[model samples]
Target chain A: MSESETTTRAIQVPILTRVEGEGALHVRLRGNEIEQVQLKIYEPPRFFEALLRGKPMDDVADITSRICGICPIAYQMTSVQALESIQGIAIDPEVARLRRLMYCGEWIESHVLHIHLLHAPDFFDCDSAIELAKRFPNEVKRGLKLKQIGNRLLEILGGRAIHPVNLAIGGYYRLPRHEELAALVADFEWGLQNSVDAAKWLKGLTFPEFEAPYEFVALSCPDRYAIETGEIASSGHTSIAVEDYEKFFYEVHVPHSTALQARKKPHDSTYFVGPLARIQLNYHTLTPIAKQTAEAIGIAPPCRNPHKSILARAVETVFAFEEGLAILKSLTMPSRSRVPYEVRAGEGVSATEAPRGLIFHRYRVDGQGKVEFAKIVPPTSQNQAQIEADLRQLLPQLIACDDAKIALDCERLIRTYDPCISCSTHFLNLHIERV
Target chain B: MSRVIRRVVIGIGSAHGQDAIGWRIVECLGRLGIDDVACEFARTPLEILDRCEGIDSLHLVDACIGPESGRLHQLQWPDERIVALRWTSTHGIDVPGALQLATELGMLPTSVTIWVMECEGNLIEGAWSSAWTQRIETAANRIARTKARAVRGEIFYRCDRTSGL
Candidate 1:
């Protein structure tokens, strides 16, 4: 087409009403070629890290947990672990088990919500969970019930579900008795079976046949699925210690986005995170039943489709319930709730798998235990550029369609990340201008 | 014998500043020694849903942005105005969305009431002023009186923000 024949078309979504936080999307097309796709996260920077400076290290977990409501446990766990590392406090074995158990509750709660209420509707072409519930009431109810079971576990262990108050720097402020945890056995047993059923149900959803050569990244534990703690691993790159994360992956400020987009070193390559990456990297470490459920449902490793992330999330939900059941059945009160630690000055870094993906936290504390410097890299920020890349790849498939369909397809693709834009500094209002 | 109604009042907020109106009012009602009513506080709509399974009457209290600050509005379920109320949720469903989901799944209480306090500034965080505290107390007393009337099976009419508390 000649320059004069080229016409500009702009498509804009003023506010992405679905998903968390506030964001907008802008796509520019020139003639038949796609020019630019920007996932513009317009939510103001929360300055959580800046606010942490000068606060006592004991206060980091509670302060960081406020970053994301859905995944507060992740924030609390990562921040607490980092501070504990700085102090060189060795937590008790039983406390470690309880921490893992608490993480299971988070995974189950966060993943199930995304699977049933958030992402599942896309597969069924419904506008919202209420619409999805109208057609799949049983599935939705099962999901909600499972989520309640997860939250119940949090309430039992963390003191409350949202920003659990139980976590201390080394361990917990208070520990629940064996009976309290034992009470969850029946619910978790129900949850395990229901999640298996839910995964099977989710597997039947038609996923788009779009796959990217993603650099799948997750924390890998030697003995079990990486949840509370693990070494960072990626499919396309060498494993690195949590402390070396900044050396490998770095963030950059783009003109259109308020959130900094992360890229791997050398070539600034974008990578994937969250459930799919975790499953891809740590498939062998999943619980016996969870592994069986995933294979039985045809969600094998090397699963590359982003749309099938819903499946990955479901399988992890099953793992969370199964893992939770084991912990409950073997429950015992720890001899001490928290380990004693002396005030010292040092820097510490730690990584843990949140329900969404790997979240890393680093803290430098003074001799008085006041935090002098703090850095938190949430999974959503790491996945932002990767999401934009996925949309770029996805647009060609949608380019032939009308602008509305193109925008909808892009949003559908983005929701698969279950991006806690609120945590990443979040929403997608889409504006596509075609020239 | 007439079956006793199981009523639950859930306060939804972060328990901070102006947002604490919901949890504070619920706390005030507890201090008032309201009889035979369950009082709970939640930060999310799903949390509210989790507490509603066995209840017969449900009341939700939260802070929202409206035309006037410190004004309390009592809107019943199925009311169109309740759907438009701006309640902040970082993730997942909002109040109206949660109610709609409950309705769809046949889990919403037959008697559902939403009590929202109008916030003056930022929706996520706020502090309670002396005036705000007074309003919270007044709202709690009014809610307590209303619940008492409901228990007695008296005719209770739908109330708007302009109506007497």
Candidate 2:
């Protein structure tokens, strides 16, 4: 294994094709020296920004929701919030609560998909959940039911699973009945335990112990751990309002990819988002149940380890469901589902907590309520650079493992970000290279 | 006698040559919402043929570009004309290649019925030109019933699984 005698090797893991969107990982090696690692995201350009032009503000939520089926609510909420912002309307707290219910469903569904089906198999040495079902049928079934319940909650609220077509600009076309909310509450009784078990299960997995200090940024509220909206903060101790996203974060385009990888402004450094950050930054604001589970797992405040993120994600899933049911319980039938707003030609900024991370939408509306310009910065695009940075740090240990082991592990790590390659490209192939 | 038919209506067209044909019939069938059918909107021949596997029967409605603008041609495969035309997926997979792979894998559909719309829209965009648009309901109903009958083993057939749209 001497450097002089060691051979230079290169392994190119091109974007794994045919799942959701497109992304790839390229890493090079000279003997044991890991030379290069690039998370190549090559999704074809879809002119979402261009497409938004001239579309009525009313249609923004409906149209942009198609951006990614997995996090449609995020797009819908951001679009709606942006439209509302243009008209100088701060929606009712009740409206925001309902939105949280919708968002919780997304978090539960998405986190279950990732923590169990997509990411867990890598840790457990299975091909997919299809395989995991054999040895752990009950566990798999639990995961499936958990996922179905989330989707059911979404369908009950929004009318469809993949893209809930019912979410309008101001609010829903129709609000939920008391019975529906009660039904969701009853179903969540079982959901809570499943989420707790999921967290425990993930906690037992072998995690590579590494703590790379990152500027963990997420929305935090003094009252509650904000999901959809709040003031943003970083572990680096800087805070910004949602309106200052473009000011604090910057997007850069590289020649190798269509995605505009993002970086923190001024410092031009990498930051992390999603579970570990949120749980770490705002552990105190978690609901009693979430806090109990965190305490049970011995996940104290300021949890810094990234590998234990699945546990954090699971905890968030529980939080989303509990919060959703609570919202449903308090919500009686409203006379009108939406409060109409006429456009006044203004610039607006909207950010929502997507299943993955913060989702941003900026729009300049025309006097006629038509969008003149639009910019959608989805979570996946933001996570792209951070994913690369993590890979750079983690590659040495990753390559030390056997190739297959490392590839699957890399896939799991990538899934942790829940990178919606489509949100980035305009896309993704998930490829992993080990050298 | 009980299971529902999965109408897998595929629309294929290449706008430049005989490419406009698939789209014409697709518009007609989309509204129909045939029960027990998994009708998917597609352009590539491979998409149509590959997805059609394991079905007891398939009613493929597509357009044939060039001189046949409005002429509706009914094709029952095991026919040379039906076998000759290539099928390719959007991801660069051809029909014949797919069939070969299917044959090797033993996954060909039990029966496949194809309908070709003779069209001349050059497979380009704006080719809503289905000469059969006028004949759509009748054409669709005719094939729908034909496959329906064949799938259920109507008079002279015996399929363990009665299937079609």
Candidate 3:
């Protein structure tokens, strides 16, 4: 269209094989020149904010959780934290412990879901886990059984496996009794072993050599890689409280897509965050079993390549199970199932490390306790730019490969972030023009 | 007279809705304490697809949508068998689209049998419909009987136990 526009950006994903939300990558190239690489998120936006405006704070958890059927716990946990921060009420220790355990279940569920069902098949060049099931029945079933264990924890503790209902501001409506939770342990322990096997199994797959410099960020606690809650930090040494995210980070809407894009202040360049970042930054905090497995995989302290992310997720699943079992062992029924609260008005930010990465919720409440304003940042939105960066790096290598192989390779790279564009869609129809 | 299935079965659509209850009817058979029946909520039709990886027989359950108001009808695919129509369901694409896609993708389970729920009479909206609600009762009963046989492995043309021939 323009004299200087020698290159065209083209990206197209027919079925977008591995990721949960359907989408495509569009990149433009000129003769020997790279033009544009856009990580187009095409999933339809469900308008969760408009849906949340009229509801009371108590309903925020359930309403927002429904936004993504795959990662509801992230929504529920973040909403609860924000609402509780607004009320300035602290939950009981038993309730806190129960919440952490549930968070662990979510981590296991989300990570395992991404690893086994969505991402792993890329290694074997398969379409879906079911297809993989036909080839490697034992491995696929092991992963599913392990994931089922995590889902069972969510079902029993959070009230339903998919979109749990019991968790609330002060605490869960009913803490799962030890006996109820104990039944899960046997399966969970079995799951942990299978998790080890699963991780080892994934390690045997072929890996790519493409690596890009990324702004790795997550909630890195002093004691653990924060999956539920912690301070926000990037490898760039920029660390801030959850409340300060707006000051250093910002969201902008791209004309090509509906999902708002996130960028660090000043530059619109992309940064990476999620399992790779979380694992790389907090390798020391991993549970003993997880650490050992990581070592066995030669992942060292931190894993940087996006291709090895399935391993990071697998290791995190092991930690989540360990953490959940410990928490479940000590949880008791609260004296009162829920703490009574009167909605007092204020603005607060609730942040948690979702399975993929940092998830934050900011709420402004009225004196009567209805939400006046709300904003949420999912991990996928934050990792959009970095996903494109990886694509840019991988595209040239994809040359000479078959269209199907290229598609599979690209999808695997995207799933490495476990992107959940379920709430937003910002994508352009990719045009792969040969200059 | 030679026996032919005169039973009108109604299938309810659930893929678009949460719980995918239409398909769950097929899924619930094993737990409901029943035996010797066929049911399925197929995304596609393929012969020998339902044959178990190890076992020798299969039953299928799938969602259905059609003209019968709270009624059931029979149809077959790949391996032809009567599909009992039971109820109508909420689905984006029609039953034909789902089956065709599954067949193309090789996703359809083998040895398929299904019942369609004709739902023009009563559609369960919001919370589940009452079991006593008359329009839905017949369909539910059809599903129950359909599922009963699946639990007995009579309709499950094959079960997965051993890998590869």
Best by TM-score: 1
Reference contacts recovered by each candidate, as fractions?
0.56, 0.00, 0.00
CAPRI level of candidate 2: incorrect
| Candidate 1 structure quality by residue, lDDT tens digits, A194-272 | 9999999976688888999999999998898999877889998778888888999888999988788889988999999
- In angstroms, the error of model 2 at A254 is 2.1
lDDT of 3 at B83: 19
Tens-digit lDDT track for model 2 on A71-111? Answer: 78889988888888789876666777777888899888888
RMSD of each: 2.2, 7.7, 7.5
Tell me the fnat of candidate 1.
Answer: 0.56
Q: What is the C-alpha lDDT profile of model 3 across A1-435, one tens digit per residue?
A: 754355333445544544555456665666545566677665566677777886788899888877765578888989988989899878887777777788888888778767766777777877665566667766655665676677778878888766678988887877777788878777877877888888888777778876777778888789766876778888876678888888878888876556777888767667787777887888888888988988887676555688888888888888888777666665575676667788799999978888878888999889988888889888888887677778888888875565556666676777777777662222223345444
| TM per candidate, chain B | 0.87, 0.67, 0.40
* Local accuracy by lDDT, each model: 0.86, 0.69, 0.66
Candidate 2 has an fnat equal to: 0.00
Give candidate 1's error at residue A309 in angstroms.
Answer: 0.4
